[model samples]
Each structure stands twice: as structure tokens, then as C-alpha cells.
Target: MSRLTERLHRMLHADDRLDREMAAEWEEAPAGKPASLPPEEVNPDTPAEQPDWWISVPFRQGRGLRRLLVVLSVLLCVGIITVLVITAQYLPHFGQAGNPANNEVSRRYIENGMEETGAVNIVAGMILDYRAFDTLGESNVLFTAVCAVMLLLRVSADKRRSAAYQLELETDDRMYEPKNDLILRSIARLLIPCILLLGMYIILNGHLSPGGGFSGGAVMGAGLILMLNAYGFRRMERFFTIRLFRAVTVCALSFYALSKAYSFFTGANHLPSVITPGTPGMIFSAGLIPYLNISVGLVVCCTIYSLYTLFRKGDL
Candidate 1:
């Protein structure tokens, strides 16, 4: 009975133990050897491949290292939980006056924002002027996301021309096509211009009013989407293609980065900057803020429209 039990155990665990032994034997064996030789016979001249010594040691010792790792991981989690509990005890009550968030930064931004950045919208001034790089990063992130989606979903021209691909496209079109619905086309004709105008207004008046680049861009993207839906890809492609998307996006990002770099360099060095805040309430006031807002809006608009087109039909 003992012998049978031992044999069953060996059979069940044969893979793990045999693989380890085989690996060890293979590592110690010479190149092109029929069988593993004594270590003394191993060639001194030939470079030996490194073996997984850590795993080999633990496995030979019967899961000791795995159990140890599990214990350590548990201990580490417990330690982290304990530390968090201790830290929480020291935190001030919610909404306390002494809270760290109630700082001078907010006060300064509110008090001297319009004079400093020439933006009537304090939030716009802070984000565009004071935290410009963060906004730039966000724009880059959106661009990156679109690029990733394109990589995954975009169909090549060669594939697009294939019979199988054309059939698939026909199927998709049949499912999603509006079939020249006069009502939708009429509504789109009336609404697209208004939506686009509203988006432009929001972008242009970002510094003077509530709207900014991100919001305006989203509105414009929606207009583009509506237009695409009303008309077909053939009509849309005549104006907006992948080439235009690439050019516009690159130019907007480059202009944004360069302008911000110049501003940062002049300001940091205490040198006179050519860009002035201008009269605060004017449309062209806030120096580079409006321009930056325009750049951001363009990027956001392009990104949104491109993503929609690519996701819907795998091209822009």
C-alpha cells in the first residue's frame, strides 16, 4: 500500500521534478553531447549558459520558497494596511480650515489672475498659462490613444480592395447606413453650421467666458460626427482625409509646444517677453492664451473626429 501510494505521488508530480532534473542535466551537459557527463568533463573553454538556479534550489526543497513568497507578500500587504491606518489617524477632519488644500495658490490665482494672465476666466488662465504643460500632456495622450486605436483597427488599402473586405464593408454599411433620409440630412444641414459656430465661439472666447479648448473641441467633434452620419464616407472623404488629420494635428501640437517653450524660457530667465497680456476684456487679449486655446481646441477636435471615424470605419 505504501509503495503504491509513493508511486502515485511520483506519477502526479513527475512533470515538475523531471523537468527540473532535465534542465539541470542539459545545462551541465557539453554542446552536442549524447548524455550529461560529470562536471569535471565539461569544457572549460566553452561558455556555459546560466541556469535558473533560484527556482531550481526552491523546487528541490519542496515548495519552501513559494510558501515563503506567499508569507512575505501577505506580510507586506499587512504592513501597508497598518501604515495607512496610522496615517489616517493623523489626517485632519474633512472640510477643516487647516486642511492642506486651503492654500495660498488658489488665493493668488483668484486675486491677480486677470492682471497676470489677462484671462477673465480664472480657470482658463490657470490651466492655459500656469499649467500649460499638463494640458499639452493631455493632448498628447489623446493623440497617442488615437494612434493606438488606428494600429489595432485600421485596414490597409490592399485589404480594403479585397472581395472579402468589400463584402464586410457592404454588410457594415447596410447595418449603419441612413439611406439618404431627407429628414436627417435636412436637420444636419441646419444644425452642423450652428454647432460649428458655437464651437468656434467657445474656443475664441475661452479666455473671456466659461468655455475653453476641450469643451469647444468636443462640440465641434460632435458636429463633424453628425455631418458624417448625415452624409456618407464618400462625401466626407473629399474634404477630411487621413493626410489632413495628420498635418493639422502635427501643426497644432508643434505650435503649442514651441509657443509654450518660448514663453517658459523668457519668463524663467526674467527676460522681456514679446507677448503681452493685452487689454483684459478684448477678444485678442490674454496674449498667447487664446492662441493656445485654439491650438488645444484643434487638437481635441481632430482627435475626437479621427477616433470616431477610425472606430466606425477604420479610417479618417
Candidate 2:
């Protein structure tokens, strides 16, 4: 019994000594040279398995498809260019006596346009009376362009939460339009009223003179741009805002459309129309030409200003 107890004590001491030696060796091991684990404890690393066959197949197929699409697109573009070139070859030369545009229509417009449309400007008489819808379409195109710009650039009011964002807005505004420029403000103060008056004159006299909705509207838009550059957005914002822009544009377009519809309905039914060609060479002449010019000018001014503000500060 004594010998058996002595053997058990020896075994316990040996196990303790073995653990201490192993711990010491592990601690002494150099950082670059880690002590190897026992063969049974060492995990045999497996190489990273290739992605699943299904996944790899799709990636390869997608690459091939992308190349094919690119080739097809190039081929399509070339085909379209070739067709256009061929078509251009058959077109009539400019200023040819036999040109289709040199027709009875031009003669009619030149001869009786003033008496029929009450517009001293023959071109205005023809366009406003004969092709007013086209003019409306052009105005709507400008409106659409501004709307698209707003969608892309305008910032949502709800998201302006942080000081950092407000600072960024101020920085951008300052960069584009200086807050305090005495020279610019002074020049604008003198020129702005004149420019505005000139624009109004052009629009009102569209039917009486060479100027019309498109030209007059462009002039007004330019004036607005000058005002924006001279005065800061805050001053402009007191009267012109996103809501005002929307309301004015919508109302003008609506009025123009309704006016045209009424004319079309009356003409188609051979009914007496309320709108008639008033006195030629007068401010109120050309039944709807002057009014249409006003509508177009409003649309143009709002669109131009909105585009500038939205782009500058992502707000309007």
C-alpha cells in the first residue's frame, strides 16, 4: 500500500513538471517562429475551394453577353449612320427654285397674313394663327427641361438637418454668387428695370413687330438672370419660390392650351369664335397672339430662374 501511494505521487509531480516546461517553451518562442502544435491538435488547412460551378458559369456567361451587346450596339450605330448618309444624298439642294417649301402656303402668308391674323409681323401672324400648337410644344419643352433639372439637382427640405449641410449650402452659394458686390448691385439697379421694360415691350409688340414670344421670353429670362447674379437668392425668394414657379408655369401652360382648344373647336364646327383678329399694329391686336406671348414669357422667365437657383443651391 505504501509503494502504490509513492508511485501515484511521482506521477502527479511528473505531470506538473511537464506542463510548466511546455508553458515556458511556448512563452520563449520567437514571434516569427511559433511553436508547432502536437500533430493531433494541428489542423490541416484546406485550400480555398473554387466558387460553385453554378456561380462561375454565370459570371463567364455574363461577360460574354456584355461583349455581344457592345458589338451589336456598334453595328446598330453604324447602320443608322449609313442610312442617314444615304438619305441625305437624295435631299433637295438648299434655295432651289423647285423647293417644296416655295409653295402657295408662303404666298398666302405673305399676301393676306396681316388681314387674317391682325399681326403686322407676317411671321408672327402665320405661326400664332397657323402653327400655334408648335409654339406651345416648344414652351412645354423648356418647362420639361427645368422639371428634369429640378428632379436631379434640387435638395429636399426635409433632409437639411445638420450644421455641416447648412454650411455646405452657404459655401456653394458664396462660391457662385458673391453676397456683397457693390459694383454688380449698382449696375443691376440701373439696368434691371430697363431690361425688364424692354422685354415687356418685345412681348407686347410681338404681333406688331419682329419680336415674338420666343425672342421676348429669352430677353426676359436674361434680365432675370442678371437680377439673380446681382442680388442674392434670399431677395429673389421673397417673391419667387418653388411654389410660385410651379403655379405660374402650370397656369400659363393651361391657359395657352385652353385658348387653342377653344379656337380649334370653333373653327371645326364653323361656329362664330369670340376671339377675332383685332386692330393690326396695336398692343391688343391679334386676338390671342399678345396673350400667348405673355404666357410664353412667364414660362421662360420662371424656367430660367428656377434652373439657376436649383443648380446653385439645390433648392428653389
Candidate 3:
């Protein structure tokens, strides 16, 4: 019985060992290679290309390199975030406006007999005389703006048809009707010429009087606007057209530039005036101050009027 039991135990142990071996062998067995053409059938004359070393090299290297790249990318991103957090605290400091230098320069110019420029308006003095060069540039800006508006406003009938793929329709004729409000229209018609005259007077007298070109020109523009609003755009358009405004603007600017240049050669700071206004305050006090005012007035008035017309007409 003891021998039989011992034999049975040995048999059980051997069975367990065989089962383990079988399991291990199943796990370790290589997977079947993809079925390939038989070596004998792979014709050498048809070109047996060498295995690409370069292609395999990249794939082999990329596994380790991909891990390296990921680590570097994480480090770089962390560093950038840290730098940004540090920088954000001081960013608002730039928005703080604190500057004394600009005020000092303006103050000095004001105290230095800028009154000799014949501008009662200190701002005007800065505009028409001190930064006269800048004014010239500004006028050119106005000119450019006017030209752009004109181009935009002028829609050719054919272009309109092409855009809509239909016949062009005429705009509402009521938009051009003469103001039948006889009382207002008549009053505006009478008053407009007078206002225009006054504006011209102010502009021409800019060198002599406290008023300068800008104010005078603005006054003139107001008169023009009054006429347009009361009578309609057609009346104003007839008189103060885009072409007319352009010519006037160019001429006015040229006159200003030429006068300044002539003053340089003659060693005179101002134009030759028929009457010089004596001292701080007088009607004929400043020599060419009134005239300069007039020039500025006309330029400003005409430009504003032109822009207004273009805008109202849907040109720009």
C-alpha cells in the first residue's frame, strides 16, 4: 500500500510538470512569419532590391528619440509658462502714463514770443506756424481722403448693373427735390452768401486779427452746409464740386509752401503785409497773421464741406 501511494504521488508530480512545460512552450513559440514568395521564385533579373538601411534606421532610432523629444518638449513648455507668469506682474506698469518732458517743451515754445507768429490762438500758432510742416502733411491727408471718397461715391451705371446682374435703377427723385419751404429756403439763400462773405473776411484778416485760417474756413464750411441742408446737395454740388475743391486745396497748400520758402530767402519770418498790427492787440496789429488765418480757414472749410458732401451722397 505504501509503495502504491508513493508511485501515485510520483505520477501526479510528473503530470503537473508536463502540464507546466506544455503551457510554457505554447507561450514561447514564435508567431508565424507573413507568407512570402518562395526564394527560388523571386527572380534576381527582375531586380531583388537591397533592404533600405536608411528607412529602417530612422524607425529604429525614432523609438528612443520620440521619448527624448517628449521629455524636452515638456521641459520647454514648463520653462515658457514660468517665464510668462513672472512677466505678467509687470505688464500693467507700461499702461501707466507718466511723462513731464512733453509739457516742458510746449511751455517753452509758448513763452518764447510765439505771438510773433501772429496767432492769437496758441493752438493755432502751433498748428499754422511751429508745426506748419505737419499742417502741410495734414492737408495732404485731407486731399487723399477726399480723393478716396470721390472714387467710392462715383459708381458707374454699368458697374452697378454688373454687380447686381440686373438693370441699374435710378435713385429716388424726391431725394433731389428743391426745398419748397419758401420762407426757410429764401432766408437760407440770402443768409448763406452773407455768412460766406463773413468767413472770407475772417480768413483774409487772419494775419491781422485774432482769428486764423481754421476758424474762418470752418465758418465758410458752415455757410456751405447751411445752403446744402436747406436747398439740397445739388445746389452745393453745382458750386462746390469735388474737382473744384481739389484744385482749391492744392492751390492753397502750394501758396502756403511757396510763401514759407520765400520768407526763408528774404530773411523775413512773415509775408509782406500791407498793414502791420502794432503791439499785443489791434485790428491791423499782426502783419500777415489775418491772411494766414484766411488760408487755413479756406482749407479747413472746403475740406470739411467736401467730405460732408461725399458722405451725405453715400460716396464714401
lDDT for position 178 in model 2: 62
Ranking by lDDT: 1, 2, 3
Q: Which lDDT tens digits does candidate 1 get at residues 1-316?
A: 9976875575456447765766788877897886543343234363222121222333444455667988999999999999999999999899989899899988999999999999999889999998999999999999999999998889777667655566666677556755678999999999999999999999999999999999999999999999988998889899899999999899999999999999999999999999999999999899899999999999999999999998888888
Candidates' TM-scores?
Answer: 0.69, 0.67, 0.53
Stretches > 4 Å off in candidate 1: 1-102, 173-176
- Residue 242, candidate 3: Cα error in Å is 3.6
Q: For candidate 3, write residues 1-316 as lDDT tens digits.
A: 9976875565445435544655566666665533332233234453222222222333333344667998999999999999999998766554445544435767756885345554455565566656667766776677687778777675444444342312212345544565657887889988999999988877765544556676778888898888877877656666776567767887887877776555444546455644333554555544444445555566788877877876665432
* lDDT against the true structure, each candidate: 0.86, 0.79, 0.63
Instruction: Kindly list the per-residue Cα lDDT of model 2 for residues 1-316, writing each as its tens digit.
Output: 9976775564435435545666777888977777764333222362122211222232333444667998999999999999999999999999999988888997888898998889999888877778888888999999999989987887655446544456665667467656669999999999999998998899888888888777777788788889888887778888888889989999999999999999989988999999989988877888988898889888987888788778777888
Instruction: Report how far off residue 176 is in candidate 1 (Å).
Output: 5.7
Q: Clashes per prediction? A: 0, 0, 18
Return the lDDT, model 2, position 42: 28
Please rank every candidate by TM-score, starting with the best.
Answer: 1, 2, 3
Span of ten consecutive residues with least summed lDDT in model 2: 46-55
Q: What is the lDDT of residue 274 in candidate 2?
A: 93
The predicted structure with the larger TM-score, 1 or 3, is 1
Q: In model 3, which regions exceed 4 Å deviation?
A: 1-108, 118-121, 157-178, 201-211, 264-288, 314-316
